[model samples]
Target: MRRAAASVTIVTILLLLTGCWDRLPLRDLQMIDVIGIDQDEKEQGVTVDLIVTSLKGAGKGQGEPIAERTTLKGPSVIEAVGKTEYMDQGPFLAVNTRAFLMSESFASDKPVEEFKFLLHAPYTSINTPVIVYAGKMVELVNNKSSNRQAPIEKLHNFIKSLNSNGVINNISMHEFISSADEPLEDYPLPVVRYHESKFQIEGAMLFHSGRYAGKQITNEQLRMLMFMLGVDQGRQRITGSVSDSKSGLQDITYGFSVKNVRRSVHTQKGTDRLPMVTIRVRLNINVFDIGDNIDTLKPNYAVVMEKLLGKQFEQEAAGMIRTAQQANCDVLGIGKHIKAFHPKLWKSLDWRKDYPNITIAPKFDIQILNTDGFEQFQ
Candidate 1:
């Protein structure tokens, strides 16, 4: 009788545990791959663009689900997200979001405010990578142009290419959140634009605090910034113009295919009692292209060009450091070192003001290597 009673109790508990509850239908769950944010010029609000991949036929890479886009403009993020339910496309889900792209206006303005929805929203991953774009946010999120691959997959490949090529530094959503607060609040994100129906790195987007400090790093500056960040290894190609002394002020373009990059950095209190930082980069470069310059074929041109390149970068690095300081931005993240190793020093003064006056020393060692079938420029 005791055993039978115990069995009945267990059955009752099981029934209670399995009580009927509101559940989301599988067909109702839509997957969001990317979110693009742009400012509504007409209104004092933001336009949220979501790129969702239809999983109607998603399986084993055999067939592709269609890519659809939706946009909603609201004064706030939550309201905008809420308005999506009324759309004919149905309520969407961001749980499967792979990337987030924000426009210059949105990213630099109230970046934190723009993304706060993700923080409170259910099923959103904090690790989602954030990418910045200067072009039309809609054009970028519209990935239906390519028939070979889905837009999300193409964007993913672009990221891999960006990292491998060292176009600019990439940051994850979590990294931005982690550092967005403390001794280092400046976050530099990668930027891409739709060019020739393809995505290309435009530059690096700079932000101060949670708002835009009215600054951006792009073009040649972007390339130098990436190299200064010590991201010059792998199959990274450094392409830039260097003036040829023999060419009577004409600039010569050169492409250095870097096989390796070794870097070292240190921070200390200068004799002047200011933050002093030094960065040293040693690069093993394969001289790939020396455009319209006979000097590259010179017996000692490799050594000369290497030194010139190092010196040129030294000047370039100084300008970049100065620009960062003027903007009170710490893209290099040297503030962490000061806080970690010298707490007292960090506490003594305002880094924002002292940063501009801080001394930055950059030394680059460029070694030209010989590609067997090509030139012996090493």
Candidate 2:
């Protein structure tokens, strides 16, 4: 009797100790890798596209499943997501989402309103990058990778590269929400497009008062913008033509890597109603390429190149500031600076009305450390 009772107790304990009793089987879970949000054409509903990978059972000899897209529509985000259950695949899980792609129209419609659902959704990853796509959400999510890598993986890696190069901010959903919550602050999101059979982060979407300003920053303007913000990642390369004093030599095109950057912003009471703001940036660079060598060993070579590069950036800064003012975007956070140091001035004026009228001066200082890479020998 005693042996039988001990055996029964052991059996009961073993049964209770078994793990994963409530866990969903892997084969039944459809993991979402990317979410694309877009507005319906009728303007009364939302469209949610889930790029997912479904798992298969053992011994099926099934290779890795290709990512498939499921489009669902409803009046709101929650309802749209809920509709995923009626599909043949298992329930949708968002914890594995790698990125969120928002259509230009959807992002322009009202960024905060459309993003609120993702902010509050349970089990969703908030740190995933939020990108603004130029084309249709369905086509972009379904597009195949050019190099045979997974489309979503390729995009994620590309974004990482751009972020490291200081080309884009790579803003996340959480960061966007935080910036939107703050006063006199705005955010820029990296913009991607399908070009030449591949996805590229070609520009950025600027926001003002939590709405798209209908402006995009690209190429040199984008680089200058990042430089002014003091966010240059030190790996950015710049190329421009500099006047060559050598006789009969055309202007030399030069390329250099940004080795270091020092930036400062100053705002003080001015003779006018709005405060005067000055943005100063100093760039330390290493010259790696010169279209034609004209005695780089000469003592004046570095000095002349530095002055020319400085002038070149000064002009670019003016254009960057113009674009920001036209969009009324305070990318530099000058208003935040005033609010922090000069509370009285910040409280007395409507920043939105005064921002466009204020004068912002950007000054650049360039230092060329070397020219050995392109040095000419007799």
- lDDT per model vs. reference: 0.71, 0.75
lDDT of 1 by residue, 44-110 (tens): 8888887766556545655455567778889876677778668754443543477778887777676
Top candidate on lDDT is 2
Worst 10 residues of 2 by lDDT: 369-378
Best by TM-score: 2
- Residue-level lDDT tens digits of model 2 in 104-187: 988887767656666666556779788888888877766753222656777778878888878877777777766666667675
Candidate 1 colliding pairs: 108-212
C-alpha lDDT of residue 43 in model 1: 86
- Model 1 off-target regions past 4 Å? 1-28, 57-63, 86-95, 141-153, 244-252, 268-271, 290-299, 371-378
